[model samples]
Target: MPYARLLTPLLLVCSNVFMTFAWYGHLKYRSVALPKVILISWGIAFFEYLLMVPANRMGSTVYSAPQLKGLQEVITLLVFAGFSTLYLGQALKWNHWAGFGLILVAAWLIFLE
Candidate 1:
C-alpha cells in the first residue's frame, strides 16, 4: 500500500514517544514507590505495544526486518534525545552527540543496498 512507507514511521514515532516516557518518565518522580512506578510504566507501555506491533507488521511490507529494526533504533535515539533533554531536564553533551552520530552511521550501513 502507498501509505505503508509513510504511515509506518509515523506510527513508530508515536509509539516511541509513549515508550520513552513509559521507561523513563518515572525518573522525575523519584519519590514514588517502586511498585507504583512499575505499574504506571506498564500501563503506558500497553499503548506502545498497540502502535509498535502494527508498525512492524505494516513496515515489513516495504522494509526488511533489519531495516525496520534499524529505523526503530534511529527513531528511538532521536526520541530519547528529546525526552532526556526536555522531559528529564538533562543536557546532552558533545560525546553523547558523537556516540549518537556513530549509531546513525550504523543505521546508514543497515539501510545500504
Candidate 2:
C-alpha cells in the first residue's frame, strides 16, 4: 500500500487496456469465426481480471466504492479512445468527445461530498 494512490490508477489503466482489447480487438478480424473470436477474447479478458481484481482491492483502501468505479470508468474511456484511434484507426468524432466529456464530469462529481 506504499503507493496505493498512484499504483491503483496505474493498475486500472493497464487493466483497461487489456479489457478494451478483449472487448473490441475482434472487430478488425471480421472474417474470423465467431467461436474463435470468442475464445481469443476470453483469453485476453483473463489478464484484465488479474489486474482489475487487485486494483479494486487496493483502491478500496483509499477510495470509496463509487469513487473507485468512477475512476475506472474514466480510465476506460481514455484507454478506449487511444485504442480506437491508434489500433483500430478509427477517428473520434466531436459527438464522441462531448459524450465522453459528460462522463468525465460525472466522474468528477463522484469525488464531491
By TM-score, who's the top model here? 1
lDDT of each: 0.97, 0.96
lDDT of 2 at 68: 99
Q: List the candidates' TM-scores in order.
A: 0.98, 0.98
Cα deviation at 73, candidate 2, in Å, is 0.5
Candidate 2 — what's its lDDT?
0.96
Report the C-alpha lDDT of model 2 over 14-39, residue by residue, as the tens digit: 99999999999999999999999999
The residue-by-residue lDDT of candidate 1 on 15-74, one tens digit each, is: 999999999999999999999999999999999999999999999999999999999999
Q: What's the TM for model 2? A: 0.98
Give candidate 1's whole-model lDDT. Answer: 0.97
